[model samples]
Target: MSKEMQEKTIGFDSFPVEIIHDILRYLRKADMSTLYSCIRVNRNLCKLVIPYIWNNPMPNTYSLINLEIFINLFDEKDKNLLKNQYELDIDDTYQPLFNYTSYIKVLDPRGVRRAAFYWLKNYYVQKFPYSDIYVDFKNNPIIDIIEKSLLRIILKNSSKIENLILDFAEKYQDIPSCNIFLLKELQQGGEGGESNQSEQLSHGIREITKLSIMNPSLKRFDNIQEFLDLLPTICTNIKKIKFYDLFFIEPTMELKLCNVIKSQRNLTSINLTYNIFGLISVIRHQRNSLKKLVLRYIHHNDICLFNTFDQLINLEFLEINECFPINIILEPLIRANLKLVTLKIIDIEGIEGKYDLVESIIKSSGSTLKHLSLNIYVDLIEDKLPLSKLCPNLIHLDLKVSIRVIDEDDDIDVESKKQPTIFNYIDSLKHLKNLHLEFAFYVIGYFEEFDQYINFINFPSLRFISLKDQHYSSNFFKRWFEHFSTMFNKITFYIDSESDEYYFDPLDDFVQEMNDNGLSLVYTFDGYSNFVATDRILC
Candidate 1:
C-alpha cells in the first residue's frame, strides 16, 4: 500500500469486528442497518457484525434476543439462553431506538422487539451475561414477525430471565386478539369474561414494582370499594401504579380514586396524571403510607374547596398543577401532621403573598426540605413575602412576583426603581439556580443591577430556569446558561398571560418576528379555569 493509504486505512479493514461494530453502533440506526446489509455481503464482515448485532449499552444493556422475540420463530422450549438477560433502558430518555424504523417496517415504529431478539438468538445469547429483559415493544411489521418467533424462545429462557419489563403502550405486537380483548373487556362488557371484581382482582401482579396502564381500555367500574380493596391485596408488592389518560365522569368517580388510595396502604408512590380524578376528592382520604404523590389537572378553583391536607404525613415530594383554593390548602397541613421535602406549585390563584403554609412545613419538618417552587397570582399584594424563614433549608428556589400595576398615564419618572414592589424580599434569594418565573416588571425593579439592590448572586448550580410572564433581562438568562451542569433536566420557561376574567395568555398566535437571530423564550399555559392562569416555560 502507498504510505498515505497505509496510514489512513491502518485499523479500518483489519480491526476485529467487535471493534468495528462498536465504532459504528452509534451511527444513525438507518446508516448502521445499511452498513449491516452491505457487511453481510462478505463472510468476515458477517461474522464480526453478527456476534455484536444486538448489543447496545448506553441507556441500559440489552441482549435484544429473548424468548419474547423468538416465540414466533421457535417453540416456547426451543429458545435457550446463551447467557443471562439484562435490560437497556435505565435512563428515562423517550427517543426512538431504531433510526428510520418506519421506512423499513413500512408502518409506524413502536419498539425494536423483533430485530433485537433475532440478533440475540442468532449470535450473542451464549456469550454474555444477560439478566434483565426489557420488552417495551412497539408494534411494527418486521417487529411483529420477530416477536412471534420469540415466544417459544422466551418460554425456554424465562426461568433464566430474572427481570422483564413490559413498557409497551396499550397495544403491543405479537399479542393475540384475545389478550387485547381482555384489557378492553370492561370497555365492551359483552361476549367475554365480565370484569367481576371478585374474580379479576389485582392479585397476579404482585411482583410488579412499576406498572403504567397508559391508554387503558378499562374505563368505568361498577365496583368501587371492591377495586380499591384489591389494590392493597392484589398488588401487595407494587410500589407505583401510574394511570395515564383515564377519564372518570360518573358520580362515583371521586369515591373510586379515594377508595383506591385507601387500598394502597403499603404503596410509596402514586401518579394519576392526565386521569379524570380531582384533587379534592383524592386528597380527602388518608394516604399516610404514600411517600410521593403527583396530581395533575385537578382544576383551578379558589372557592375554599381544596383544604391543605396534613394526612399525607409521609409525603416527601408534592407536584400539583392546574389546581386551586390557595389559602385553604396550607392551613390544615400546618395545623395537622405533614412532612414534605419537595414542592412545586404552578398556575393557581388566591396565593397572592402567603408564606404561612410553607413556613409551617419548614418548621414542622425541622428544616428537612431541600427544594421549593411557587408560581402564584399576587398582583394585589402590597407586602413582599418572606420565604427564607419558611424554607430555611431550601437548596433550590423559583419565585415570580408581581408588583402593583402601573397606569398608562403614570409619569415614567414618577415610578422609582428603588422602591420595592410587592416582591422585593424574594430577589435576595441569591443561592438559587433552576430559576423559574414571569417576574413582575416593577416588582423586580428593586433588584435592578443599576442600583446596588440587585446583588450578583452566583447560582453555580442553576441549570434550568422557568419564567411565566415575569419580565426579566435576557442578559441574566445568558449568564445562567453558562453555569448549569450537563445533567440538568430541561431548562424550560413557562410564561403565563394575564387578563381580568383570568390572568392567562390571550394570544391568537405567538407571532415572533425574527429580524436576525433566534432568541430564548419561556412560556407556561394554565387556561383550564377562567379565574386562574398557568405559567408556560419555553426554553
Candidate 2:
C-alpha cells in the first residue's frame, strides 16, 4: 500500500474502540453492503461488524448467493440431514466460518417461507419450460417440509428468542397439526405423554410477546377459525396484535377473534386494516388494557360497531382511514366520549354530513386531543367548519380542501353563502404546531384568488405547513411559500402531478431562490403510495 494510504488506515485504527463500535453499529443497521466492505479494513473492524451482520442472518428476500451462505452455516451433521431428508443439494466446496444461527434472538418464519418459495420458483423457471398454469406452491409438499425444517432448526438454535411474527400462510391454514408439531419440538421434554406434551407446548409458545400476522395479500384461508382461537391459548401474555390487509372478514373468524380477545387480557394495542369484523370483535370483548387502536377502510355500515367504543376505558390513540359516509360515524364516536390524545380521520367522503360530523368530533375531544388530521370531502374554503372549537391542546393539524375552482355559469350567489373562509378561525387554536393543508383542484391561473385567501389569517403556534395532494405549477407553489415563509418555521410543497418539462425549470429556480434568501422551504413529489408524507422527495 502507498504511504498515504497506510497513514489514513492508521488514523482510523487510532480511534477508541467505543467510537469504532458506535460508527459500525450505524453502518451495520443502515447500510449492510457498506458494513460488509469494512470487513477488509482491519481486524478490529471485522470483529465489531460480524456480530451485527449475523444477529439477523436469514435473508428475507430472494438472493441465491445469500441462501448459499445460510446453507453453509450448518455443520456437517445438519448439512447431511438436509441432504438426506429434504433432498436439498449442499455445496461441498463452500464452508462457513461460524454458526450464524446462534446469534439470532428473533425469528420470522413467514419471511423464510416467502424467500424459499421465491428461490424455488426462480430455480424451476430456469430449468423447465414456462407454462400458463402456474405452480401451485400451496399444495407443494417439498416446500412445506423445507419451510418447517428451516423454522425448527432456527428455533432450536436460537436459545433466547424474544420476538416471533407469524404470517398465517397456506401451510398454517391447511395443516391443523403444524402448530402442535412445531411447538412439540420447541419444548425440552419431547417424550412426555400427550397431556404433559400439550402443557409443555403452551409453555414453549408463551416466551414471545410481540406478534404480527402481516398477510398483505389478504388471502382467505380454510380453517381460519381454529387458527385464530389457537393464538391466545399459546401466547397467553401477548401484548400487541397487528393485522394487515385482512380483507376477507368472516363471521366465524370474527367470533374466534373475539374469543381470543376475551382470553388475552394483556393485549394493549391492535392495528388492523379493512377488517370490520375484527374491529367489531375488539369492541365486543371490552378489554380495559387496550390503549391504542387503528382502523382503516371503515365503511358506512360499520357505524353500529362504534356503540361499544364507550366500553374501552383506557383507549387513548385512535385513527380511522378511508372511512365512507364519514359524517354519520361522529355521533356514535362523540357519544362514546373517548378522551383521545391523537385522533386522525383521513380520506373522509360523503355529501351532506361532512360539516357537522367534524364539528362534533372536534368539540367532543377539544380538551384532550393533541394531534388531528382530517381530509374533508367538500371544498374546505367553500364549506368551512368551525376550527375555533378545536382541541385546546392540539399540536398537529392536517386539513385538505378538495375544490379550488368555481364555475362561472353557476346560479348560486357566492355572497349569499354563510360558510366561513379557510383562514377565518385558525387564530383561535393556541397550541397548534404542525400544519398540513392540501388544495386539490385546478387553480393554475388563479394565483390572485389564492393569495387573497391567504391574507386573512395567522397561526401563532404554527411551525410548518405542507401543501400537497394535487397538481399545481411549480412557480405558483414557490410564490405561495415565499409569501408565507415568515408565517411558518418551514414550508413544504408536494406537487403530485406536473408536466416533466414545465416542473424542472421552476423547481430549480425555487430551490435556488430558497438558498439565496436563507429560507426553509422544500419542494417534493408524490413518488410512491399516493400523497403520504413518508413518500420520497425529488428535491
Candidate 3:
C-alpha cells in the first residue's frame, strides 16, 4: 500500500472502539448500503454491522433470503423435522458464522408468512415444473408447517421481541396453528412439550411494547378471540395497540378485546377502526395513561358514548378518519382541553356543525399543536378557514379539499364565485414549515388565481410544499417558478387521475429545466395500486 493510504488506514484503526461503533450505528440508520459496505471493510466493522442487519430483517425485500439464513441456524431436530415431515431439505453440516437469530428484536408474522408463501411457491415450481401442483400451493399444508417452524426457531433463539404485528386476513385457516405456537412459546414449552423454563422465559414475548392486530373478517373470530384472551395473561407491559378493519366484532368478543386493553398497565396509544361495543367505556379506563388515540370509520350511532373522550387528559395526538357525526366526537375533545401536538381529521362526514366543531377543536389545542391535517369540502375553503388564528403553532399543515359535482345543466357562474384561496388564511402562521394541498378534482380556471395568491403571500419558515390529486400543466408550474422559485426549497406534485391517457411530456421538460437551474422539483404519478416516478431530484 502507498504510504499515505497506509497511514490513513492505521489512523482509522487506532480510533476507540466506542467511537467506531457509534459511527457504524449512524451509518446503519442513515443508509443500509453504506453499512453493508462498512461490514466488508474489516472484521471489527463486520461484528458491529451484523447485529444491525439481522435485528429486524422483515419489512424488507431481502427477508426471503434472511429467512433462509435463519432456517440454516436451526438445530438438528428442526432440520430433521423440515426434511422428514415437511419434505424440505437443509444442510445439517452447515453452520452460520454468527448466532444471527439471537439478534432478532422485531417479529412481523405477516412478512414471515409472505416470505414463506413465496419460498414454497418457488420450491414447488422447481420441484414439479411439468405438473400443475404448484397452482394450488397456497392451500398446501407445508406452508403452515414452514411458517410454524420458522416462528419456533425465532421464538426459541431470540432473547427479546420488541414488536409483534398479527394480521390474520383472507386466509386465516391456512395458519390456524400460529396462536398455539405463540402460546407454547410464551409458556416456555416447545413442540414436544419439553420445558426450558429459565431460558425460554427470557425469549422476549413478554417484553413486547408494540402490538398491531388487523382482523378484518369474522370468519376466524374464534381464533382471534382466543389469541386476544391470551394476551392479557402474557403481555402486561404493552404500550401501543392498533386494531384495524374490525367491522364485524360481536359483543362478547369486544368485551374480551377490551379486557386486553384494560389489562395493560402502561398503555399509552390505541388505534381502533369501525365500531367496537363499549369502546368508549373501555378507553375511559386508560384515559390517564393514554397519550395517542386514533378512530377510523367510526359510524356508530351512539353520540352520547363519545363523551368519554373528555376523560383523556394526557392525550397529545388525535386522529379521526371517515367518522360521522364528527361534531359529536370533537365536542368531547374540545371540552377535554387536550394539549395535542398532532391532530388529523380526514374525510370527516357531517352536514351540521362540522366546521364549528373543527375550529373549536383546533382553538382548544392550538397552543401545543405542531402538525394539523384536515380534509374538508371545497365550499368551506371558499368560505375561508381561519387556520392561522386557530392553530398558530402548527409547523406542518395538510389541507385536502373535496367538492360536490356540478351538472352541465346548472346555471351557476363558477368563475364569478369568490373562491378564497388557502393563502388568505395561512399568511399569519409564521412557524409553518411544510404545506400539503390535495384537491378531489381539478378546478379548471384556478391556476391564475393560485399564482396570484402565491405572489402576495410570505412564508418565512416554509421549506416544502406538496400538491396531490390534481392535474397541473407544466406551463403553470413554469410560470409559478418564474415568479416565486425562492419561496420553497422543494415542491412535489402527486398526480392522481382516473384515466391512463394523461401525458407528462411538458412536465418532464419542466422537471429537467428546474434541475438544471439548481432547484428541486419532483413529479410522482399515483394510481390505485402503485406509484410511478416521473422525475426525482437527487441531493
Ranking of all candidate structures by their lDDT, best first = 3, 2, 1
Q: Relative to the unseen true structure, what is the Cα RMSD of model 2?
A: 6.8
For model 3, residues 334-402, the per-residue Cα lDDT tens digits are: 889888899898864423237777777778887798998887665555555567777878899887765
Can you write out model 2's per-residue Cα lDDT over 462-502, one digit (the tens) per residue?
Answer: 65555553444555555565566545434444444433756
Q: After superposition, how far is residue 43 of candidate 1 from its true place, in Å?
A: 22
> Alpha-carbon error at 519 in model 2, in Å?
8.2
Query: For residues 1-539, could you state the per-residue lDDT of candidate 1 as single tens digits?
Result: 89999888775467775666666665435465665584556666654554234332112234342333223334222233221133321222334322221112111112335455445444433444484533334533333444433322222222121112332233432233222212233234424354553233231233346545333223432232243344444443556656556553344544544554555446677766553535344554446567877766554445344454656677888776655444455666666555677876654543545555554565676456677766543433234344544454566766555443448895543244433432354444444444554555444433454222323333344444443433433344333333331333333323343323232222212213221222223443562111111222335
Better of 1 and 2 by lDDT: 2
- Overall local distance difference test of candidate 3: 0.68
Q: Model 3 off-target regions past 4 Å?
A: 1-38, 58-63, 66-78, 84-88, 124-141, 174-196, 220-224, 348-352, 378-385, 402-421, 443-448, 468-475, 488-515, 519-539
lDDT of each: 0.44, 0.59, 0.68
Deviation in Å, model 3, residue 172 alpha carbon: 3.3
Q: List TM-scores for all candidates, in order.
A: 0.49, 0.71, 0.80
